[model samples]
Structure formats: structure tokens, C-alpha cells
Target: MSDFIAEQDRVLLERHGLASYEALWALTLEAVDEPNTERGGWSSVYRLDLGEQAFYLKRQSNHLTRNVLRPFGEPTFAREFRNIQRFKRLGIPSLEAAFFAKRRINTERQAVLVTRALDGWSDLQGLLESWPRLPGVERGEIVTACGKLMRNLHAAGQLHGCFYPKHVFLQRSSGGYAARLIDLEKTRPLLLGERDRLKDLDPFLRRTCAWSDDEVRHFLTAYLPIGTDIERWRLRLDARRRSKEFAVGAC
Candidate 1:
């Protein structure tokens, strides 16, 4: 029995043909509507539906280096599971993990993770693709909100290693817009360093190529006040733009 499988979910997993830890490797998965990048390659992810409930299954194959360190380091699936709980305890919106399992396959390691789906949410990147059309004030509000959320995460001593648009989800509810972070495999506690914290800004800046200078200015101001090394961040962002590493597409 996999200890990570929640007791309430065990019967559901069995009903879906995942009766054992090893079964996860052979379980047939239905792909959800997501970018091709999320499909099977180095890893496989699926959207599982059991009656009215929805969940996500993510299985990853570890590299040789990671396999070698299995004894000393926690598996990716375990780390993500812990991080999800940490985010929730810190009052940061995120999904809940229902199951996690890890096993060695010869020299390589394989792992599986299961989480409840974040329904009624859309990625921030998709929203920003229509940047040219959104009202200025609304756009500013989203930018400001995202900046504040990121600041809070950093202040909590956690680093979202992949701080990209696709990992950030936003939903409009009766109260207002709420933002949540996902894909937490790389999340970890922050050590003592400014560079690590600064790295979080890169992905946001890269996704803003479609934004006007005024929008970027507003975002930075809301993120960190003026006279707080704003120019330094701008220079670093511009350098990435010049390099054309992550091309920002237009709508």
C-alpha cells in the first residue's frame, strides 16, 4: 500500500484501476486540454475524473543524478506534496495533493503525484496575451495583485523556483479575483541571498513583452516601491529581452 494515498481516496483510486503503487505506471490516463508541453515526454500528466470529483495525476521519471541521490534527498513527488501543504498553511492559495508514490526502476526512479484540480481557474499567461485589449485600470490591478502575492511568498521564506505565467492561475469569483500558484515541484525554502529572490522577477518580466512601458512601470511600483533598485531590475529584464531566450508572443 502506498502510504501517501489519502485514506478517503484509496477506494476511488482502486475504482479507477490504480489499486497499487506499481499500477500507476501502467494506468491509462486521459489527457486534459493543456499545452503540448505538458504532455508525455520526460513526464506524463493526466486529468482524472471520478464521478463529480476531478483530480490530476503527474508522473515523472527521475534523471540518473537524482536517482543516485534518492537515499539522501526526498523524492520530487514528496517535496511537491509537502510544499502544497506549506502553501496552504501560509494562506497562499494552491491545490491539494491526494497521493504521492516513488519507486526505483532499475537505475532510474519513477514517481507519481495526485492532486485535486483547480476548477474555474485560468492561467495568467493566457490572460496577458490579450494585454492590448484589457482596460488599463484592470490590467494594473492584476499586475499589482500578482506583485503583492509574489512578495508575500518571498517574505514567507519560500522560493517558487519556476515563477512563470503558466504556473500562476487566476479566477474570478463572487468576491473578486483570486490568484493561486501551481506546479510546485521546484519550490523550496529560501536561503540567504538576494539573487535567488531576484530570479522570481525574470519570468514575470519575460511574459510582459506585450505590455506597454507604463504598465511595466505600474507593476514594478506595486511590486516594490520607487527608489528600490527598480532600475537594476529593468536592466536585467531588458538584457533577457535582448537575448531572446524566452520569446514573448503577441496576440
Candidate 2:
């Protein structure tokens, strides 16, 4: 397939022998300890190794009919590339795109996006799974940091549509803990309303992190101002939790 490489990445692209989209998909990829492979009927992802470094590569294809409702075509790779730029511009820690390409043949469209690997990072899910092993004071500090990060993201008028535990990556820096959100294909502009902000927090609390009511209240205190209507936020979170419990029981 045809391709395009940024001028700055020309040498790296050439060195990796990734000149075309076809070549990139054909290259051998190494499996990490994590479940790095994500597969679906129309898309797939792989963690690729280039010498000692690694990259995250995602490939997607769709029929022209699926592109009818999309304005700039269904090139999700490009969408992710732009979203990563948005996160960085907003001063939110995130990944970097190393390469992107879109190709069309007749009525079919295909795209690929490669991102520089996050080497020394771990998903919040893994950390939370080992939560009991961590010191209580350290855990409280992490939750507070997460709350501040969420507050900053919402204040910037952006929403991470799928804010699940697995999508949040954490790393320990000299200063403290650094957190970043990933899988930004569904990210969109946030409206100027608490409803919009709550939408992000609800699923994150219900489906992702397993924080209790008291913990949620504590987090919101750091997420919002001291005298904010925290009671209202707690009510909303409780409703979300009950609804999730009901849905699971019904199934």
C-alpha cells in the first residue's frame, strides 16, 4: 500500500524498513508480558519491536458505506494522531505518534498508525489489582493525583469518551506519580455543563477504578473546590453505581 512519512521520521522509517503501510503490517512483532494484542472483525493492534525500542501499531479497515457518515473518511489512525497532539497541547501526559498512513483501493479504505511505545509505564488496572499491597498513605496520594488530573482535563473542556482503568497509564518520576490517558480515538470536546463532566466521571468510577463512596467523596474534594456542592456529585456517583449493579444482576 502507498504511504507518507514525516520529514523528521524519514531516517527512522527507513532504518526500520517501514517505507510502506504493507511493509509495516508484514514486520514481525514481539509479544510483551501484557495483553498487547487487540483484535476485532475490522481492526487489530500489535506491539512492534524495532531493535531495542518498541512501537504500538494499529490497523483498521472499513467499507465505503461505513465512510458515508464520516466527513474526513474513516481513517481512525489519523484521528488518534490528532487526539494525541491535542492531549500534549493541553499539557496532558500522552503518547507520541511516530507514523500514520491511509490507503484506499476501490471501495475499501485502510489505515495504520504507529506510536512510540511507553516503555516504563504500567496501566492503572495493574496497579489497582495490587492495591492492597501498597501502603495506605501512598494509595491516598495516588487517588488524589488522579482526581487533580481529571479536574484539569475537564477544565480544559475535553472528554476522554472511554475513561476505563486500563486506558490510564501511570509511571513514577522523580517528582511523584505521572498519569496519562490513552486510547483517545473517541475523545471529543466537552460542553459547558456539569452533565458533560459527570458523564466522564460516572463510567470511570463505575466500570474502572474500584473506589468506595467515601473514597469517591474524597476524590471529588480534590477534583473540585472546597465549598463545591460535593453532596450533589456524590448523589450522581451513587446513582451510577446502583445502575451498574442492577445491569450486572439482570444479566
Candidate 3:
């Protein structure tokens, strides 16, 4: 078998040092790969199919300015696998995680967390982009679901560093809508505080509320029941505005 997991059959993978569950799959690193998306996302994301199951393969983001050398080697996917495990333990709704060796994708010889793809999920971003609009009831329900999940994640001591609509996978169901967190890299637990909570909202405000600020406020207020201490959530909104300022300065 080749070094990649491109075939449909169960390939034999050396379990020598695999961390993530997907990495446990037999791999044959064939060059066949699918384009991830049209919108400019992280440069490293790729889509790979192993016949029965599909997987998303991506490289660590090089966007950070400092800490030039990434924490994990380009050779191993252990770091990401550990993070996914953290989420799984917290009971955050997410896909199953796995680890896979990727020598060709990144020179450092690192592993990539292989998450089981949602059987039928269309990213909220794409859904919205294609539809152009959603009904008040539908939109409210959607936002409410997102808000509840975020609250649950926060209470679980986990934060999705990038809590945007795109990162969220939505699938219509008999009840309402089911959501899942795709990436597990930046998510981490934090004490209830200003900076940490603010950091958590930064992504949501930018991605989830890409439209009316008022609607965004309503969405958050509904999901997170911060009864008397509205100040805490207010500060979170402010931090998002501040993050925008830095971007302006850079430009």
C-alpha cells in the first residue's frame, strides 16, 4: 500500500505511534486529493476519501506571528488528537477523532487528527451563502441551537477558539438542527474571566454574527443564560470590537 489512506478498502496502518482513531485506519498515501472549499480557508485543509469513510486532512495554520516553530512536529498528529479527546470527554457534540501519519503533507513528519465526517452535513456558511436568507422562525431556531451548544461547551470548561458558522456543521433533523464542532486545535478550557471569555466570543461575533449586531446580541443573550451578570457577556461583545481594531491597524 502507498503511504496515504486513499483507497476504499480497510488499509493496514502501522499502529506503532498512531494517536487519533482515524490514524488507526490503514493508509496508502495516493496523490488523489479533493479541493476543500471555494472560500479562502486555512491553506492546509484537504479532503480525502478512504472508500467507506471520508476524512479531512489539514496542516496547522501558519497564521500566528510569533512562535514560528509550531508546538507539534509536522511529523505527528498527537497534539490534535489529544485536543479532540479533551472535547470528547467534555461531551461537546463533535465527530469521532483519530490520528494519521502524514510524511508527504508536512515535512516535519507529523500526524493529522482524522475526524469521522458528518454523514450529511452542509456547513452553515455555505448553507446561508447559497440561500441568501432564512426565515425569522428558522433563523431564531438556528441561532438558539447554536447559543445553547456554546453555553453547554462553556459550562463544560471547553471553548471553541473559532466559533464561527462555517466551523459549525448543521444538519436538519426530526427535532430541529444538530450542530458539530469541526476543528479542535484552538479550543481549550478556561476559568470564568474577562480575557478568556472575551477570546471565546471574538470568533463568534466575527463569523456567526457577520450581519446585524443587534441580531448577534440577541442570539448570544438567548443561548447563554447569564441572568443578572449581563456585564460579563457585554464585555465579550466589546472584545470582539477591539479585535477588529487591530485588524484595521495592520491594514
What C-alpha lDDT values do all the predictions have? 0.73, 0.72, 0.56
TM-score per prediction, in order, is: 0.74, 0.81, 0.66
Angstrom error of the Cα, residue 44, model 2: value is 1.4
Model 1 lDDT per residue over 1-251, tens place: 25587777888888877756678767787665442332222466798778877888887765222335365544556677778879978877777777887887785667778888877788888888787898876676677767777877887888898888888888765555677799887887789556677667776666656777877777677677557888787886667656655545422
lDDT of 3: 0.56
Prediction 2 TM-score vs. true: 0.81
lDDT of 3 by residue, 1-251 (tens): 11333232234123233333344433335433543333232224455665566665454322221124654333224445556667778787876653343333352233344556676987877765643367666665666677777777777877677776677787777787777777665666677555675666665656553445566666678666667465567775775677665532121
lDDT of 3 at 97: 53
Each candidate: RMSD: 4.5, 4.1, 7.0
lDDT of 1: 0.73
lDDT value, residue 134 of candidate 2: 83
lDDT of 2 by residue, 1-251 (tens): 23556566667778868967888867766533443224222666788777777777777666221244566556666677778878879987777777788877676677778887888988877877787788876667667767877887888889888777788777776666777788888788897577788778877776544566677777788789678999888787777667665533121
Which ten-residue region of model 2 has the weakest summed lDDT?
Answer: 32-41
**What are the runs in model 1 whose C-alpha is more than 4 Å off?**
5-26, 32-42, 61-75, 104-108, 225-251
Ranked by TM-score from best down, the candidates are 2, 1, 3
